[model samples]
Target: MCEKCETGVEILTRNGEGRRNFLRGGAAVAAAPLAAAGFSGSRAAAQPSDALAQSEVQAWAARDTDGTFAPYTITRREARPKDVVIDIMYSSICHSDIHTYKGDWGMPNFPLVPGHEMVGRVVGVGSEVTKFREGDIAGVGTMVDSCGECVNCLADREQNCLNGTTFTYDSPDQVSGGVTYGGYSKRIVVTEDFVLRIPPGVDLAGFAPLLCAGITTFSPINHWDLKPGQRYGVIGMGGLGHLAVKLGAAKGAEVVVFTTSQDKLEDARSFGASEAYLWSDEEGLRSQMASFDLMLSTVPVAYPMQQFLNMLKLDKTLVNVGALFPVEGAHGMMMGFGRQSLAGSMTGGIAETQRVIDFAAHHGVAATYEMITPDQIGEACERVVNRQARYRYVIDMTAA
Candidate 1:
């Protein structure tokens, strides 16, 4: 019998209309009334909301391989209350991870583990967790913790919590009493608030980067709710830009891709872009000026924005998605003639994050990812920062 809210299903003691509630009280209670009778646990999902944690596990960690990455083994902590322990099936390598791991963003913690786009199942859940249970599929993204009582948290904008939001890795973990590690490992333990519930039927492997790459692109588009027939330009076609392309198209808007690479024109169109605007082409440049409702620049290098600002019409915005040097345009008034604005955004609140996931699942929008093993982490990171990778790279932890 399936319980209300699809909480779980119980094995019936009989068949068809003859069937009454069979195995009671748990999601994993197994077998048809005509056959065997025993609990099969659950599909690494569908676990009852009140099951115990499993024991023993494995993982791949960051190790030095001649200034590159090599494999090292690691352990997972047991689950506790409000905790959802995920056995990582896949993880994605992000540009931020590459920057932080190489110490290019500053002197990073040595052997600083990297990976926030993680997908897996709940091998365990803390005693008080009602949101998830053993075997339920789950994910953790760029953020992990926040001050629950802050204005942002109370308002469902935990990404901008009054206190600095705690990153999944490289940030403090109050429960662990130490710096947090990331999804590159075999398992991850996160609070119920930070963990995401995935819609069923998608491939779990390719879904990892959707946690970060998908959301990073997803947040800004959703925040504005730019409408149908509205013009939106996605500036770049790398990991993040590519996602923006699909998301913008799903919004029922005309999505234009702005790229320095002419070779990506076909790719841009293939990835849901209605049009491709080459930055160097005078015609494209002229058409972009004062034309778009929103322009999201995902290029990693600093670019002169005077031209970009000229492209926004009245009440329009040119938002920065990529964190490049020079920070913001030096001349704010340059954006004012058309009443245009310049802004920047990070990921999003847990509520917004959930909404994006649901939206993607509904629209069948997914990130394009090249899957690799842990040994490929270094090369993947290098390519990401060097702007060599076409879109995104997801680590297949199962292969590791």
Candidate 2:
């Protein structure tokens, strides 16, 4: 359900620190912009990137403390025996990108190329790599690497490995001798181990967010063991909730949603919610308490703890997929009564991410996205921060 689009409330977005900029439309073109840097954007990201053959590759980079992103040229590493170079097509905008760009999460590495939900084709792969080669469609999500030999890595959960995971962007990668840059660039060089094959025929523009938003929502549902005929609830109607609705509905579970706007009622229904309730309708919500088997929250802001706790049935769980914020106090006895547990999840692991891809392929699930160009990235982030986007926003890297 595209609530923001339906209500004529195009999510409000402030400009690049007061500079007014509207999003560029259509698919990611990876077309080089006329920036001084002579960049060709995501086009240069294909595997075994042949930058030497191309005149330029365009990319968005945060070169200054002023906070506006500018176009620049990216030089791709030559393909090595284990290397797979991808030319980014589209990059999904996630809340974490907002935090990183705004310098809210921590001090960002300047010239920070902000993006991670990347989709592109394999333009080049080293001879040693059999999984991918020129023209293999793929995606790179939240993780890029782990130390590979830890107990957790051996268990196929690199994200939980004792050796801290190597994140796709904005984290340590001593091997690179620099903080890892992300998919906002026209191209990226990764080991074949980190690349994922994207299912064919899906809308590449809409499919961008599935790398992050899709996996984020699907993990908890699968982990929680949501089965056919089960009752589940999704809180909030933004990016995560919308996908949760479709996935839950596709899973044969009856999905109920709690939204802030009565305007979203019908839209939520389209996402497969058997029922929808406005959060402001306290009386109605209170009347039907403790009934959901799983209450999955996608809201990033704080909410009254006790009110939502009442919605869970015995042994039910409320899974938080959003970031940590200040939550209010509630009585331990209330949760103790039902043995209801509140848990949160980060991004999915590599293997689980693969499962998410297969699930989306089998179920025909994808994200509802607004495609923007590199020039519009700063604006897009501002829109997402201000809650003004229609579900999700993906940077059309091809337009860089």
The C-alpha stretches of model 1 lying farther than 4 A from their native spots are 1-67, 328-330
Worst 10 residues of 2 by lDDT: 18-27
Q: Residues 1-400, candidate 2: write the lDDT tens digits.
A: 3332222212222232110111111111121111102322324332233432332456787765445888867654455676677778888888877677667666888877767789876676777766654655678988887877877765456677687887878777646467777888877777766676676566666777777788888788777777777789888888777888887887778899888866778988987888899988878788659888887888876676667777888888888887567556555888898687888887776666765765676678788878888888778777777677778888876666
Q: Which digits, one per residue and each the tens of the lDDT, describe model 1 over residues 85-123?
A: 776777887777766765566666556677788877676
Error of 2 at 303 (Å): 2.7
The collision pairs in model 1 are 44-135, 45-135, 80-126, 290-311
The residue-level lDDT of candidate 1 at 118 comes to 87
TM-scores of all candidate predictions against the true structure: 0.83, 0.84
Model 1 lowest lDDT segment of ten: 30-39
Residue 317 CA displacement from its true place in model 2, Å: 0.9
Candidate 1 accuracy as lDDT: 0.70
